[model samples]
Target: MATDDKTTSHPADPARPGSGDKPGSRAKRAMLGAWFGFFVDLFDIYLPTVALAPAIAYFIAPDLGATGIAITGGMIFTATLIGRPIGAAIFGRFADTVGRKRATIVAMNGAGIATLLMALLPGYHQLGVASVLLFVALRLVGGIFLGGEYTAANPLAMEAAPRHKRGLYSGIINTGFPLAYAAVSLITLLLLLVMPAQGVDSAYAQWGWRIPFVIGAVLAFVLVAYYRRSVDESELFTKQKGTKTPIKTLFSGRNLSAFLQVFALMTGFWLSLQPVAAVLPTLLGADGIGMSSQATTLLLVVAYLLLAAVDVAAAVLSQRIGRRTFLVYAGAVMATVATTVYFLLVRFGPGNPRLAVVCTVLVVIVVVCPWAVLPAYINERFPTSVRASGYGLAYSLAVIVPSFYAFYQAGLGFVMPFNYTGIVLLGVGALTIVGAALAGPETKDIDFRAHADVSA
Candidate 1:
């Protein structure tokens, strides 16, 4: 069950090297390709966050109330999260029927084209109401394809990884997300340094945001080529590709428990993480932390780097111990350490850069690092026949709930005293996940090639 005992003998693995070849190198390449595909998908997803401020100023009419801008901003984010499920339904089916490689190629290209189109869209000044419509449409398109990328790439990577080291590979793949987030932040920080911040009217603020989208579009296309040329289809997938409906297959009685387990796990995972990931840096300044803009940016960069490192370490440790044990302990940490850190950061962040950094690091370690092994864990839950569809559906739906974390926090902020809303929500989310994890079976030693019955 441990790393040394599991077979590395997937002779039929499409990416497997021939006699006298370095098998490890080929597998590593495949993993890196999957990781990069995820990286680009996340980069495109986070673009809206970086663009939101400039977008609000440029795209909204001044006469409209704050509610109008808030609604618009919320819609922009909601549109993408909604579109992902739709994409998951479609591409998940496509991946099982056609091939993971083909589905990935199509999805990546679709996302890249949609992203490039965003760069060409007119702002409110040029297109008026049409601009908002176009923006939403483009975001929907990007979200759909990005969702497809997740469904396809994750299983491909998990199946490609050496069975014993799936956790390690999952950790590497998870790093793609935070790395892209950090990259976007770095890009935005640099742009803001030079761009004027003259509220709502600064030309650079309005147009400069487009530059990153353009770069993302280009990166997407490059990934399309790279994935097509470099990545291989999962041998497990190839062996089990079926002619039946994957979605329906997932809901059959035999697979229902696995589906529900993943759904709960994904829900708790995303709901707990998004608030901290999206709000922590903003909270630093809002809490009256005396950190300068330069200091804030540096802190965020360091935090993300630390997050990446923790992800790897946590993933490896999960393999050594057990997935269930690690998850249970991780849930405990999120419930206890992360919540306490958030409270301390909010209460004591004023004039304390060192304290702020320390608190942020603690939150990252507990709340974020444990998620690194999720791809592998989810993949382990189902057989190859419905793995992509099940993972995609569960992940997409789970993400939809968390997408509204902003609204949840806003509501909590209104009712809660002393701005402890975030800490409380984080605890609730972590406990929800912990409850779900307690119901799940330990899957660390599950054989990738073995499958459960598809029918009741």
Candidate 2:
């Protein structure tokens, strides 16, 4: 499971004979394509939040009130979480069996079609309870595609990246989320300004909310075309083919330990990160903590911008410091300080936008840094043959359960009650730190090809 200390040398030109450059060159481009697809996927997934108010108004009866709509929307989000694991199972196996290129294509295209259909569907008044059912069904389908996208894309990027630069490359790929968030935020702002709002009734019933979904569908299609023309099968997969490493066998041989390790790591990561990352803004916004919608949007955009930069930097830093040490130290610091940071926000958040901004900045600095290095670290743990499936299954299982909890908490109007949520996050963070300290292997300067069984 350990990569050899000796480095493989090649000619200057990767395209020339005896040069190991072609695969490296191809991997770089493929990584870009994979991340581009990921960017679009993130955009589509988050766009719904911007339209949540309108969606509820259109679907729920006036007598039912906002609480009812909140509950319904929460259900949809939970349903979407359920679909993620299904997507991971189906697409993860396909990526291992068929190929990463084909699997990615299917995921991107399927998500696009699902979103487009959602854009066209009628509202509650027009379709009744059937409308809500249709929305949930479509979200489920979209979730499946989304589930497959990350599993295939992350492994593809990692396998393609140069060994020395894998951490940085992985970080760059993950930066797509923040970039997509910024883009979606900008788009939502533009739509809010331009769209004629004749109150919640007309906005939701007519066309306001559909605009973003339509735009996202178009973006998805565009990404599909881009990936189709630019991306190719990973060299690592080709090199490791015919090794008798089917999906089932992955859990049996040397890969078994690696799989468990990744599963445990991801579980802790998701449990600590998802709720804080995804739920905090909505929680703060709805709580009337003096952060108006415009101010909150501005703060999110700024935080994401910082997150994108820090994430990439952390990835590059891992090359010098080593992945294990970086994750362990960083995870511990974030976990230990997160509760204190939340307390700071709750204390100073009532009338002070400046203090709120500071708290926001602190949260991003802690949460996003460790997340940046994970894709590369996980990728280095498995062989190219079963990498996609392994990473997908592990990451999805970790994400789905925690994400469900996040939606449930939001639905129940839970927040920093006696610092309960913060305590939970801190515990998970401590677990991540402990896991890394105990089990994480140093991947610095290791040859990815030689370490095919590192997770073993």
Candidate 3:
């Protein structure tokens, strides 16, 4: 359907450029398919951030209070992140054993179903705590599927892309995550615009948030079809079809450091990136800023767009300077800018909306670049045999703590302004990432075509 040949392997290998049976077109299809699938997957992931507070408050309102709502929201996200590593371990194995295309289709379908179920879930008023439990359960399911997505899709894309252009392509494709967030922010903002301004919270909880989940669910299914029709198995993976025990291979002494380095990178990257991307909306709604939901959504939409642009630029530049150098510098810059902007937002954000928006745009630009180059960088670290599982497991495990950043910020809010809490978290995370990247090797010039039996 997409001029992709399922029966034969393509020329572009995930690890290195090679002369294969076909032209570079297969790689193009993989990149496009991976990009779209991730767009839908990440859109579903961040949509909850926009809806979580209002939706949970609707359930546990008077009895649970703000503290209760905050705890519940944090638990839901935590469950989602926790489930991801489990999914990655399982699905990454599948990606290695069966094929990337099979894993991708299964993961997408599971995520779509989980999201659709969330849309149909009864409120806390009707089912009481049972509603909350079911919601958490479904989110966990979604997390598993979403976790599997990165393992298969990112490797497929990277392996398909030309070695010389990996940095640029990696950045462009990974932009899906931020762009999806921007899309959700825009949709939420539009819904707020059309609805009556009065009783906004009540209206949003009642039905407004569900609109986005419904859209995400539909989008996921569409991507499933698109991928099924267009995506072919990775050429590099195809050559390694008979490799024994992918998970086992990953833990071999020679490959151990590669795993560890990626783990550190993923941990540092998510720790730094999640607070700004996921927690900023809640932070804005807190007492210090007290911005309305509509205003926050508008701010995030603009900020996410800026983040996407900055990520692309950073990704392309990584090609010239090398991934390690780019990440180290980016993380350091984000730390300085985020720490400074936290104060800026606190001093002027409440009284000056335009200034807050401008500062937010700048903050996102710095904080988001580290994530842009990770897919290609991580992909380059391992051979095709264990690439999916190694990358997925590291990526999923690294996010475990950051997933709870919202809850941590909420508690810290009592002792300090939430903005300061975010800044501290961002600063720490940026430094951690920079330190890890500094220790890790540059992946830009690595020969992916060679066996990844030894750590660089």
Best by lDDT: 1
Give per-model TM-scores.
Answer: 0.92, 0.90, 0.88
Task: Kindly report which residue stretches of model 1 are placed more than 4 angstroms away from their true locations once superposed.
Answer: 1-4, 7-26, 199-203, 287-294, 410-415, 453-456
Instruction: Provide the global lDDT of candidate 2 against the true structure.
Output: 0.73
| lDDT score, candidate 1 | 0.78
**C-alpha RMSD of candidate 3:** 5.0
Worst 10 residues of 3 by lDDT: 1-10
Q: Please, what are the lDDT tens digits per residue for candidate 3 over residues 1-456?
A: 112223434444434423232444666677777788779878887777765444556556456766777688777877787778988998899998888888988998999999999988878778888888888999999989988887888888887676667777788888898889888777877776665324325677777778899999998898789787876777778875624588888887756788888788777777777667666766677465778877777777777777787777888899889988998888888778777886798778887877778777777777876688888898888877888888889888888777667677789889996667877788888888888888788888665555455366
Q: What order do you get sorting by lDDT, best first?
A: 1, 3, 2
Better model by TM-score: candidate 1 vs candidate 2 = 1
Ranking by TM-score: 1, 2, 3
Name the lDDT value of residue 29 in candidate 3.
71
Q: Write the per-residue lDDT of candidate 2 for residues 1-456, one digit (tens) a residue.
A: 444324545445543211234554666667787678778778877766765444556655557766777788787877788888888888888887777778888998999999999888876778777877888899899999988988787777777666676777788888888898888877777767776455556554467778778888998788778768876676566666623444686687778887887777777777777546665676467574667777788888888899899988988898779988887877777767765676678776768777878887777777766778878887777777777877777777776556655444444445546323544655665566557545857766556566346763
True-vs-predicted CA distance for residue 149, candidate 2, Å: 1.4
Candidate 3 colliding pairs, count: 3
